[model samples]
Target: MLSQPETSEALSGGSTGRALVIHPVSKTPPGRVSNQVASRSTGARLDEAVGLARAIRLDVIRAEVASVSRPRPSSFLGSGTVENFAELISEYEIGLAIIDAALSPVQQRNLERRWQAKVIDRTGLILEIFGERARTHEGRLQVELAALTYQRSRLVRSWTHLERQRGGFGFLGGPGESQLEIDRRLIGERIARLKRDLDATRRTRALHRKARRRVPYPVVALVGYTNAGKSTLFNQLTRSSVTAGDMLFATLDPTMRRLGLPSGRQVILSDTVGFISDLPTHLVAAFRATLEEVTEADIIVHVRDAHHPDSEAQRSDVLNVLADLGLDQPTEDGLIEAMNKIDLLDPTTRLGIAQQRLRNSQNVALSAVTGEGCDGLIEMIDRRLESASRVVRLDVPLTDGKTLAWIYQRGEVLGRRDDNEAAHISARLPEEDIARLRHRQRLH
Candidate 1:
């Protein structure tokens, strides 16, 4: 659990006070400031920080990028910069200061005291968003586990009661336990229990995957940076009613649906939590069970917001996260790129994207909002799946309409001939479907 004064209200949607979002650009040579992402500008990073703050309903009164030539160990910012923000906080009466970087426990505490406001770093802000956006039981568990893991390291005795000692139960007791120790112990116990529950969740997910394999439909997963229109594209592809919005971390829970391809074959389309630059490691580990839906997907779609200025940087960030998840091959060669939000692009840029798509069969330029070029994406998927299927011949009784319909729905028909007694059919199908058809024949 988070300490009440530090994060209880801020993370639980109780705090609606004014906030100041700051992005610190580090100066490597003591003279030049550089953005965190090599291709992204400083303003973009600050904008993202502000967006993150607003995602949790924080009333952002001010936002800026602070250049740091050298960091002070106590505050992670130069003394003058700290004093400058302190004045801004006082002037605007800001109740919260969002630092767009990871802060050590001491630095976080010192900054809060200096600014006379609650301070949460990037990790904390992201966690707060996750805490608010998580709706499912599993999502809550994963968020809680990640939150606890992150909070464990920042136990800097923020409360006065943490220093007090509890009396031992024994009469001739030696030293009693301090409140901080008790809190740490309790948090540790909760973490252990959560890990056990998550392990069970992982096992359950594995079993579900196995069951899906039994009646196998190729799984296609949508993955990209937060608010890159993955959920929107998912809705467009599968015709689902999942909540899709233009907010960061808008969709936390994984949603799956059955989708019919152009070839009349079907697939399982999965919309998963979006990836982001500098996504907390604890979150990546804790949400392993949920992300397994991505790792196990037969087809991976890398969606990009082509209209955004930092599009290329966001692409690199998403690929970095995928690499961390041990999915190197997908981003390298196997994945399909969906250049989303082309409806927002100017005609010249959209034309360029169209030309790029003509050069690469795996690249698709589409707008999930207007449903433009989405058919092209579906056709691309259909062609890929068709190329991977094997042709097989089947003979069915004229009376058995069910099996014939099943074959037609599950495979691409190449040829068919009807006789008085039976129908001979040739179709392209997956090996799993072929085996199942053979098994169905044996049962009769």
Candidate 2:
């Protein structure tokens, strides 16, 4: 058992708050190297659990490592450990107990009875955080759907008294008799309605995406670990004041702005919600519609906080998520790494790493807070876009002025000449749109 000091303050409405964290550790035999590795990994996970609890301002009163018992069925600490935890709860007056693992509804209910407090599993805590952080309608809806799905699984706990309720209606009866059943049915209907609403929203978003594609501006999406300075870099690049806080999940909505690159080419820059280690699978599934922005982007900018101790691990985590989304394939040649927060490092170290990364032709390094190396980043983007584009030289007859005007509007024309019979035009367009333009020219 490990105890950390608790601050004396009101948790909510002057109610004292204290929480206990329970982590189950496997007691595998010492000879196996695999078990050793597993134990080491479990220790690291416990540390992260503590850090997360502290980040959320939870008053952690005690942390315990209980040896696993009945692993096949219970997958949690043994009965003796539960008894000891119950004793600790009585002694410390804990209002909540956070189990750093997924729990079945029966396990959750049993634990709550033993501790006489609200029991929250790792998934529940993350859902609560997301619910609090969601700022946009789509974000809130996604979170709500995920929460409802998770809640549906725990409906067993919710209707524990079903066996005791003698019914006159065979589980679906009289007007007011089956109140619990009615409530459950109503909830099921609501969940169905929400799913329909979300489907409609997805369609609307698809139409909006089509409209953006018609504008023909390349989109650059910023992606990285939470608190990796994505929103900060977005603000620095676009000069728009979006919420850039040090807290996790600060930017829930995808924000887009037109950014003028170094070559004077305008592109759309999108700042999306950040990724995290062990992000809930349900949350990922729920947010896939919004995260498709990354897949649609012409360039994916991976921003990283160079100052954090676990920056490398954070990078790996972000890459794992990207790989899961199929955005880490070698075919995705549009990935750019942006190592941010160089200003927080010592000047010599910052310059050395920046120079090294630049030399390796990996990506750009910049400090979003101080506007350092931002010009180089923009220049790199412009260069990549220019390289991927194709230049077309077309001589359209002056009789078709509309074609020339459309060309000027759709692409960057480097030169235009008027001849007695035709208008000679040299312009650059994205490779994908070149064929369309060629067909339109043939029609003219």
Best by TM-score: 1
Best by lDDT: 1
The digit string of per-residue lDDT tens for model 1 on 1-444 reads 223343323322223257889999877784676545678988888888988888866789989888887677889999989999988877777767889999888898788667766778888888878876778889989988887787777665332222224311110111222223226787799899999999999999999887776465778889999999999999988888898998888899999999999777788999999988889999999999999889888788889999888999999988888888888767423478999999999999999998998898779999999999899888877777776678888889989988887777666677989999888988777667788987867222
Give the Cα error of residue 440 in candidate 2, in Å. Answer: 9.4
Off by over 4 Å in 2: 1-17, 22-47, 54-57, 62-72, 156-184, 328-332, 346-352, 355-359, 396-425, 435-444
Each prediction's TM-score versus the true structure = 0.82, 0.78
| lDDT on C-alpha atoms for all candidate structures | 0.79, 0.71
Off by over 4 Å in 1: 1-16, 30-36, 157-182, 331-333, 393-444
Error of 1 at 189 (Å): 0.8
In order of listing, the candidates' clash counts read 0, 0
Alpha-carbon error at 393 in model 1, in Å? 4.5
Candidate 1 vs. true structure, TM-score: 0.82
